[model samples]
Target: MVGALAVLAVVLILWQILPGALNVPRYVIPPLSEVLVALTDPVAFPRYVQNAAATMTEVGLGLLIGVVLGLALAITLTQLPRVYGIVFPYIVAIESIPKVAIAPLFVIWFGFGLPSKVVVVVLLAFFPVLVNTIHGLRNVDRDLINLFRVNGASRMQIQVRLMIPAAMPQIFSGLELAVANAMIGAIVAEFVGAQQGLGVLILQAQGRMETPAVFALLIILSALGIFLNLFVRLARKWIITWERT
Candidate 1:
């Protein structure tokens, strides 16, 4: 925490000094003080809070749906090798398509509302979890499986007692990736079409040439992404304590 604070302080000092030192225009890069003022402005702060809440709601819901679906599909594939062989290629094909290209299709299907944003988040977040879970499960120690078989352990028992626990670290790694993707997906959906969200606020600020407000919004978004990533790291430590042991 102290290290993070020190880095933040240095960045803030640089942000406050660089533009003026370089004789840059305020319209291009507002000073940190101007951005802080925009961030704390009474008229704008409340709206920012509301839009942040909306974006977070979409991110949370989409993360839940995507992670659940990905885990389920991964487990199914692992349990059925024939199905895995048949479906893996198609999964690769689907993932090859750029999510930005598909965002419009979701907007047309779900409209300019929370649903569309959630769908985009799901699409972006799902692949990481699916890929990681499959990799982890497939790479489980064969000796462990043989030992379980020697004990006459059922397939379900082997999975629950050994495989899942061993795969948790990789799954958590996927979760970290999902966290960033979820935020990006929400913002992209908002950019495509939305009445409220940080993305929309950014567009509005840019249209009005509110450079300070734009910088303020970017700061808020960066802070949010950092917070979410830190939360995931904490959760990973809790869930995989054996790693530290």
Candidate 2:
């Protein structure tokens, strides 16, 4: 924590002084103080908060859908190797396409509303969770599987009592990746077009040459990402406490 504080202090000092020290134009990189002022302005701050909340809603909804679908598909594939062989190649092909390219299609299909952004988030967040889940389930010890079989454990029992518990660490890792991807997906979808979101605010600020406000929005986004990442880490620690022992 001390190290983090020290780094943050250095970054703030640099942010405060660098633009003026380097004679950088305000249009390019506004001073940190100006951005801070903009961020704290009662009117501006509330707008920022509203837009951020909108984006976060999309992210959260998308992540929940993505995680549930990914876990369900992963389990199905693991249980049915023939189905896995048939489906995995298609999944790889689809994932190979840049998701941003598909965002426009979603916008067209869902309109310029929350649904489009949520869909984009789902697309972005799904792959990591699916891939990690498959890896975790497939990597279980053969000896453990045989032992369970010899002890007359059913396949469902093995899955519930052995595979899922063993896969928690990897699943949590995937969830961490999904959280970050979900944020990106939300912002990117908003960029394509949105009624209200941080991305829209950013575009409006850029158009009006409100460089400091734009910087302030970016700072808020970064802080949000950091907070979410830390939350996921704490949740993982709590959920998989057995790993420590």
Whole-model lDDT values for every prediction: 0.93, 0.92
The candidate scoring highest on TM-score is 2
Ten consecutive residues with minimal summed lDDT in candidate 2?
A: 94-103
- Per-candidate clashes come to 0, 0
Q: Considering summed lDDT, which 10 consecutive residues are worst modelled in model 1?
A: 95-104
Q: Highest lDDT among the candidates is held by which one?
A: 1
Q: What residue runs in model 1 are displaced by over 4 Å at the alpha carbon?
A: 1-7
Task: Give candidate 2's whole-model lDDT.
Answer: 0.92
Q: Per-residue alpha-carbon lDDT of model 1 for 149-223, expressed as tens digits?
A: 999999899999999898999899889999999999999999999989999999999999999999999989999
